[model samples]
Structures are given as C-alpha cells and as structure tokens.
Target chain A: MSNKEFEQQLQRSVAQLTKEIQPQRDLWPGIEHALNHEQDSQPKSNSWAFQSMAAAFLMIGLFGWLGFNQMQGGDRTEQLVTVLSEPYQQQKQRLLASYANQPALTDNWQQQVQELDDAAAAIKLALKEEPDNPALLKMLKQVYQQQIDLIERVHAPAWQTI
Target chain B: MQTQGQLVDAQEHFAERAVLNLIEAVKAGDKQAYQMLYQQHLGQVYALCYRLTADRALAEDVTQEVFIQLWRKLDNFRGEAKFRTWLHSVTSNVCVSYLRKQRGWWQRMFNLENSEAMHEVAPGSAGEVDLDSLVQRLPERARMVFVLHAIEGYRHEEIAQIMDMAVGSSKAQFHRAKQLLSEWMGYEQ
Candidate 1:
C-alpha cells in the first residue's frame, strides 16, 4: 500500500476512537476519599491512611461521643440514627435496602438529595486539590451524615404519614 | 468537513466562555466551580490518562493526580489559551512524568508494563480485533507517540518537547505505531 493510504488508514482508526472512556469503576468517590484523607496529614504522611476503612463509623463515634448523653433511655430515633451511621458496608447495605424503596413522607427529599449530591461533588473536587484539611473532611462527613439522616427521616413511618 | 469545522469552532467558543467564568469562580476559592470544571473535562482527562498508561487502574490514579495538580495550579492559568488546551498540557506532563519515574532503565529497555492489567483484557474479545488490546500491546514510547500525535492531533515538534526526545525520534515512533496498527488491523481483516 502507498504511504498515503497507510497514513489514511491510521487516521481513520484513530479518528474512530472516542475522546472519552468511562472508567470501569466510579473513581470520584475514591478521589474524594483520598483527597480528604491526604489533607488530614502531610503529603507523605500515613496518618490518614486508615481513613479508607474509616467511613460511616467515624461519624458513629463522633455522634456517640458528642450527643449520646442528651438522650435518656433507648431512644428509637437516636438508635436508628446510630444504625444509619454505621460504617460497616455489609450491614449498612442490608439496612439501607430495607428502606430504599419506601415512599418518602416529605415532598422535598429529591431536592434535598440533589443538594447533597452537589455538595458532595464539590467537596470531592476541592479535596482533590487540598487533601489534608480537617475542616473539609469534617464538612464532607457532616454533609454525608445529613444525607443519611434526611433519607432515614423521610422514610420513618412513625414520624409523619404522607 | 467545512460544516464540521464550523461546529467545532462554535463548540470551542462556548466552552471558552464557560471556562472563563469557571476560572473566575475558582479563583475566588469556589470549590464547587472547580468541580463543575472537573465533571466537564474528566472524560477527556481520563481518556488521555488511559491511552498514555495503557493500564485502567493506573489511568484512574493518573487522572485523579492530574486534576489534583490542576487544582493546585489553577491560578497559574492566565487564560491566554483555551482551558482544555492548558488542561491537556498538564495531563500530558503528569502522565509522561509518571511513566518516566515508574520505568527503570531495564524496564524501558524491555518495554514492560507497570502492571499486569494490560494482559487481563483478551486480544480478541467477542470475536473481533480489539484495538485497545492492540494499542496496549504496543511498545511504550511508540504507544505514547501514537496517542499524542495521531489520536490527539499533536505535531511532532510538540511531542518532541513533551517527551524530551528528538523530533526525528518522535516521528519515528509515530510511524512505528501506525505500522503496527496497520499490521494488527490487517490480521483482523
């Protein structure tokens, strides 16, 4: 084949390529986590390395230490909040599935979730740039907990009937 | 072709405007605007990383790393050129620097992949020539050159500067990539 023909063939093949290839996994979550984790420590520090395994339970510990004293006897709302905040993936998945399909009692849940999603995306992006900031990590966790609480609160049948 | 060119120009103008607005927001420390930019440009960033590394996992890491660097370096952008152009330059630098650092003298000579992920995908999945599989099989320098030049529309001079190689070497690697691509495509046909 002529060199021009070969070059054309190369161009044809290359042009057929898509400019974007979706990753096999959703990488944003990891990116967000990494950014936050790194921000809590030095660029080369291993201090926040444990954060990968320190998901929802970190909040559980925080909430328990902070506000568990306010509640008297076994408050179901507080109890369910603790359960919703659990970090164990398996248990959390099973627990969430039970309430995943229920109709929300509140009308604004979708908008609330959209706001949380946007907040989370924005936090992750910032975390991508600045990884060791404790304030950002706390904010990210709080935003996440608010999302969980919102979901649980909306679906709690005893609280409101819609 | 003319219509396509016009369409590309229009899209570019629109993107330039969006990027200008985003850069202003980001400069004011608007993290959300930076993320908006991330979502807008991630596909191309990721695609460049994957094509550069030829390993899916590494590409993901590289993609994240590029954006992280971009976030830190966002202020350096003077807006003289399109943001995409600036981002592309950053992506290229990060990927190439990574490959250089990861490759030891012997590894570069032997042309070994940093990870075994490349071999995980079969050469002919679903009974057709997998161009990705073929591209991954390419020798490292040639693959990078092919991606930058043929796929990304980079001139040999720009590639030479980016790869820190002679202009003639860049052209040679590009040719080598095409020759191999033709061979693989021919075999499939």
Candidate 2:
C-alpha cells in the first residue's frame, strides 16, 4: 500500500480505537463515589498533625504568659524589698564606720564613747516598743556588746610589742 | 465530528467553572458542589484508576478514596496545571499504593480476564477491534505510557515526570506502543 493509504489506515485505526475504549457511562457513578470517598479521607484540621500543632501552640502560649507575669512580679518584689531595707543598711554602715579609728588605749576617746552611747539609746527605745520579740532582744544585745567592747578596748593600753 | 468538538469544548469550559465553584463550596463544606465536581471528573479519574490497577473493584475503591482526597486538597490546587493532570497524578499515586499493598504480580498487572469472559464481550468497533482489550493486552509500562501520551495527550516529558521514567524511556514506550498498535491493525510495513 502507498504511504498515504497507510497513514489514512493508521488514523482510522486510532479513531476507532479511541471511540471503542471511551469509558462507559455506568462507570461514572463508581468514579464519582471514589472521588467522594477520597475527598472525605483527605488530611484536614481534624487530622492528628493539625490537632497536635494547635495543642503545642496553646501550651507554649500559656507558659509564655505565666513567665511574663512572674517576671513582672519579680521586678516589683525586688523594688519593694530594696525600698524597705535601705534605712537599715544605712544605719548599719554608720555604726560600722564610727568604730574604725578607735585604739586599744587612748588619752581622750570621748567622741567614740558618745557615738556608742547614741546607738545604745536608740536600741533600748526600740526594744521597749517590741518587748516580747526575741529578734529585737537579740539585736539589742548585739548593740550593747558592741558598745561595751569598744569602750573597754579603748581603755586598755595599746597592745604590747612582742 | 463538529458536535463532538462542541461537546468537548463545552465540557472543558464547564469543568473549569465547576472546579472553581467546587473550590469555593468545598471550603465551605458544600456537599452539592462536591458531588457535581465528582460527577464531572469521575470518568477520567476512574479510567485512570482502572488503567493503573487493572481491577474494577480496586479501581472503584481507589477512585472513591482519590475523590475524597481531591475534595480536601482542593485548596492546594494552585491552578498551575490543568486540574485533570492533578487528578490523574493523584489517581496514579493511589493505584500505585494499592498495587503495592496487594503485593501480587497478577494484581500489579490488573486482573487478566479469562478467555471465556473476554469472548463474551462484543467488539464495539469494526473488524472485531476493542480498544480497551487492546490496551489491556499491552505491557504494563508500555500501556501506561501509551494511555498517558496517546489517549490522555500528555507530553513525553510530562509522562516521564509522572511515571518517574526517563524522557527517552517515555518516548521509546510511546514509539513502541504506536508500532504495536499499527501491528495490531495489521498495517503492512
């Protein structure tokens, strides 16, 4: 057969074949059913991955908020502690500095003796106000011993050289 | 011929619009549009499943599953390629998985019809030629390549990408399928 005839034959065969294999109308119902089934089964927010992600996000957010609140609370607590404790720190510093220059024996230690007298007077007043408190009594005793030690030590002669 | 062209064109336009409509409806969980969309593409999807699995029941099952998946993934369809191509790709993947799960060579090759069953079906075309039977007779790879390239009108490159074969292999398969078809038709060299 000629090339033209052969080409025609080939085209005819293809055309006929395409028509013959075209899917039946009845098959569409099953196909549609499959499509619906597949659509139903696809991954959605209902799936485990999505649920897990949402749960993780919620947990992280809760922890983050808690941490933020605690951080703010800590800052406030530190500020209050500092404000309440500042005067006590200052009083302690004055007491400590006044004793720095006292010697074992001094000709006239009147200034050193006066500072100790004032501190002891302040402690006595505070103890009278809070009479039953052991902490207050303990502090009062510490101040008394410190004053007596300062005076006694100053009255003693300078340390003897070995 | 003109009517067929008109019908195909109308179907194409309808399919495009229907898909867009389905996208909106599916997002809103509209069952009606989903059904409409499924009806529109069912044949193509099932044909793909049937071709890949070679089992009517399995193809039906896979087709069902594929459509459900397609509905859920409608948002993911970026309109980059034709929706049909996306559908076919999904169908092919589902069939591959089913075949793998079945783990039998015969199942992989599709239920080869017994001679008696084959004889029962009348040829719809002249000269006792039934395209489906002829397609079924092709080697798995060659048949897949043929259906994708010739019937489905996919390019060799696209077929290669979809089938995970080299482009040359796809082209060779197409060439082999054409030659075989020509032989089946008893076309003289």
lDDT of 1 by residue, B1-189 (tens): 999999999998997998899989988867788788888899999999999888887787667667666766788889898788888988998888766644433263334734354334344232244566678877788899988987788899999998999999999987777776666555331
Model 2, residue B29: what's the lDDT?
A: 76
Give every candidate's TM-score on chain A: 0.40, 0.29
In the range B104-173, model 2's lDDT, one tens digit per residue, is 3333223442323333443333344556666665656677788777666678897787777899999998
Best by lDDT: 1
Candidate 1, position B90, lDDT = 86
Which docking class does model 1 fall in?
incorrect
Q: By TM-score, who's the top model here?
A: 1
Off by over 4 Å in 2: A1-10, A13-162, B1-15, B80-82, B96-128
- Estimate, for each residue in A109-129, the C-alpha lDDT of model 2 and write its tens digit: 456556545655664565456
| Candidate 2 local lDDT, residue A67 | 49
lDDT to native, each model:
0.65, 0.55
